[model samples]
Target: MTATTSDSTNAYSTPADDGASTASTASPAPVSPWPRRLACTLVVLVWPLIWVGGLVTTYDAGMSVPDWPGTYGYNLFLYPLSTWLLGPFDLFIEHGHRLLGAIVGFVAIGFLIAAWRGDQRRWVTVLAAGVLLAVIGQGVLGGMRVTMSARVLAMVHGCTGPLFFALCVVAACVTGRRWQRDRVLAAANHTQQGQITANPSTGLPADALRSPWMLWPTLLFGVAYLQILLGAQLRHALPTSSPSMFAHTAMTHVATGIFLWLLTWVAWSVMRGCGDLTLSRPAAALVCLVAVQLLLGMGTWIVNYGYPSILESLPGSASYRLASKNLLDAWIVTGHVATGSLILAVSTLLAVRLRRRRWVLTQLPH
Candidate 1:
């Protein structure tokens, strides 16, 4: 008999070699979707939380209750629905904020437990735990803001909300099915270290394989957040400051706004050319959001500080008096606040995605 062997058979001559290939190509462990789903739900609820928080400030009702962890004489949870719904608008908003915050807190606890129990990632579990802790701290800060009537503490509390909300959004994103899928692919391909080798499976262009270019996002997030702080200071400051002092703050804010707008355009230009749809899409959204914010910024001036006094001398301008905190004022200003938070959250999410994708690409073997 003639000794004949197939080419495939000759190639894999040993079982050990085949087994090694299988082991090397194995996917990462599957992530539970439920934990991420719960996190997403928390993200949804937090939006209205920020909106209501803005309304509380819009109406200047942060001190309506004169108490913390409780509503008037009753425990927080037991506060009568009738009283909350029928009370003065400020009290209603203030009390409703507390109630909504409680709900968010409970949901966050559930999210933490789910992530800790269901997630295989130790870091994810740690992050979930941190979110829970942060929520609790937020409530305490809110309470202290009311009880101590501290404006500085109130601003701190206000700023904390956006950061926490961004965290929730990021948690949801990482726990998501797509994220898990990418993670598994990265692991199987040895792309986890963020350095893309010249491998055929990477599918990335030479430019895509470069660093994530994180500096622009960092600058955008920082500038956007600082703008928010300036806004809060302008809106919530005591009315007793000298005109020169107020003018200085106002001028600084305007200058910063101009600089921020320029930076955003530059960031948008870079993102628009990135060739990656993921980066480009969010970058487009960022551009649109900033444009809307500019118009709203103008509206904020029209509503709070009235038509520019310098412009009153112009034709067809003298008929307008500056509107105070009316319905339109509340909506415009509150939307401005909420939109700022949204921008920050978007920036954070984009930054995380870029970092993760780059890290995934890096893990592939050459």
Candidate 2:
């Protein structure tokens, strides 16, 4: 009897010890900050790259170098700085854009290395690899645009820049310490919803598992990308495009802009109501940015083609003349282009973060 009681106690104690060991072993390792920092740096570099690329387009300086992978028959990096600096405006912008692109590529490589080395998450590593691949592809596209002198290629290149930037932002988000902590907490919180009668976080109905609000960020992202495509089409319209076709495209673009503005406002309101700062902050920015973009769209038109005859009755409108290729015209046009990229980046971040949050929520009792 004594031996049997001792054996039973040992059996119970052994399983408890093993369970504790398992829990400790399963705990996630600490995330490294370096990967996140490097990714953020890559994201920053891409914005100026987009801006300079826009300037190249705004000034018609795409073919200034007339060579791919080289400048004036000299190696790209070996080209004389003095000539590049003191050269004509087109050469300066074109060469500078190329150099900036190369820098972004190098930073992407560093990010990939850091992620693979420090980030234990397979997805994070894959995200870093995707960023590098995108940077390479973007470089190739830009090169092809120059070698083939295809305007279509130019448009594609322009479109991909923001997409690549968006990926970098994602990489940064996933590699963040807060993201890792949230993932671990969500995993720990994992329990069958059937086991719990109600959510402790909120007293909302269990049916709120698939909330309609969860889809808004994703919808906003889609609309924003569509707007980008339409804008690119208008910006790179072929010489053969008829005035009627251009007018049609412009009207479509304007209609889409108004719809996007409304959608952004709705998204902001929903996110704010949810009280999720991560989603709401970007949503708010998207609202402000879309508003600014609409204004910039107007400024871009006024700078490029001047105000309408109807607006001529206004004091400034009557005096506003379309300055062909002036400083102000270039800045306004480039600002519009750059702002579009910014809006897309912000929307991408919000969409991804919200998606992750929703996934976590789905795993919980709610």
Tens-digit lDDT track for model 2 on 206-310? 333357656877787788888888889889999999999998988888999999999998888666655455667899999999999999999887877788666
Task: List clashing residue pairs in candidate 1.
Answer: 190-363, 190-364, 191-363, 191-364, 192-363, 194-362, 195-362, 196-362
Residue range 119-208, candidate 1, lDDT tens digits: 655577788888899899999999999989998888888889998988998888777654632342343233344343333433444334
Model 1 has an lDDT value of 0.73
Candidate 1 C-alpha error for residue 285, in Å: 0.6
Candidate 2 residue runs with Cα over 4 Å from true position: 1-22, 26-30, 181-209
Please give the lDDT score at residue 262 for candidate 1: 82
RMSD of each candidate?
A: 8.6, 8.0
The weakest ten consecutive residues by lDDT in model 2 span 1-10
For candidate 1, what's the RMSD? 8.6
**How many steric clashes between backbone atoms does each model show?**
8, 0
